[model samples]
Target: MKKLLIILIACVLGSNIGFGQSKTKLKEVIVRPGGQKVVLGTKREKADYGHGGAPNNPKYQTAYFIPAKGASGLIDRVGIYIFQKHSFLEFLKPSNPVYLYLYKADAKDLPGELLVPEPLVIKPKKNTHWYWVDISEYSIALPNDGLFAAVSWPKATKEDNGPYVGMTNECDSCPFYLYHFPSEPRWLKVDERMKKSVEKGNKEKLNQNLMVRLEVSLKK
Candidate 1:
């Protein structure tokens, strides 16, 4: 009985120690209200279009560049304007999850190294307005040169019809760009292209800016 008790206590102590060592420390975070918001991308009142529909669509990715002025702030929130027009049944159904990745721009102003190795997975929310994701606990620091926020959606299966997020046409010279992964990945200056396409009445090449924005607080 004494030997058995000793073994049990030893097992319990070892288990506690292992659990302690595996625990990860979370970062300090504080959520501020909309009034104290500092937006890092093009602010638009409404989105005019939706992108990405079919399975393995090249248009599944979109990105926005952080400006030099806002690069010193600590990112705490990410907001994406989305629209869901499907039936109530489809809306309730589970779909492929969307992921948000932070990447550094290369020499060609393309997405380079991924800053967040473990990309943040976004929970799909049904909303008429902007869907916000709180990421303050991640302690994401805006890079000086600029960082790109890229959102990639999972391939849409036959049974699951995924939701499409809104895209804005408000920013004519917006710093935000859209990424397509058809063959070799490429970044498109969508706003400029859309403006020119509209002027020329070229509907074939028209594209708009993804309604993705970041909220951050500058370090004191």
Candidate 2:
């Protein structure tokens, strides 16, 4: 009986080891040389306007639709060019934080599902030409048809006016984009929103695609 017991114990241990070896392994993805990069949306050669304000305000939020083709990848980082405005200088300081969000687009091409449970917070680096936000650590996966990225600023404080990201009037090859307005109940496409605002002579409500880019690693 003692011998049989010893044999049973050895068999159980061997089975566990075999099971461990048979477990599936995840494929490894490496950041490509020069970093797999994609620039969506449009930015003017000279940005004539800025977007952002308090959280409750009708702030300008930008999103880029990852095309159905070649959308499988790991997002490493993203960056947007911030324009310098004398009127917003205090709000554009390094101390101010910008928030980033990855959302799944809905049927109407509006921001739908929130991809990350917690929003990623980015603080601008000192004197950097571009406000680069690094999120490689999160290992965000780009869904084939539903992925989009957005950025927004928190409410302004008495000490700061709140920073606005720079955007040009140029809209060539720009991806489907939308913006939220303080008065509007939903996100509207830039073209549609601009047209409606123009009809009402509300030119101040107009905006354009932000200067944003994404660095991603294609799945092997």
Clashes of each: 0, 1
Report lDDT per candidate.
0.56, 0.52
Best of the candidates, lDDT: 1
Q: Point out the worst 10-residue segment of candidate 2 by lDDT.
A: 16-25
What TM-score would you give candidate 1 relative to the actual structure? 0.68
Off by over 4 Å in 2: 1-46, 54-71, 85-94, 125-128, 157-159, 172-185, 193-205
Q: After TM-score superposition, what is the CA distance of residue 175 in candidate 1 from its true location, in Å?
A: 6.4
- Expressed as tens digits, the lDDT of each residue in 1-220 for candidate 2 is 4344333322221221100011111212333475545433332344545554444442545565544355567776666655533335643545566666778888877788887777777665443245666777888787677367777666534345345555544553444454554444455454543334342533332334555656566665
**TM-score for each predicted model, relative to the true structure:** 0.68, 0.62
Q: What C-alpha lDDT does candidate 2 achieve relative to the native structure?
A: 0.52
Error (Å) of candidate 1 at residue 109 is: 1.8
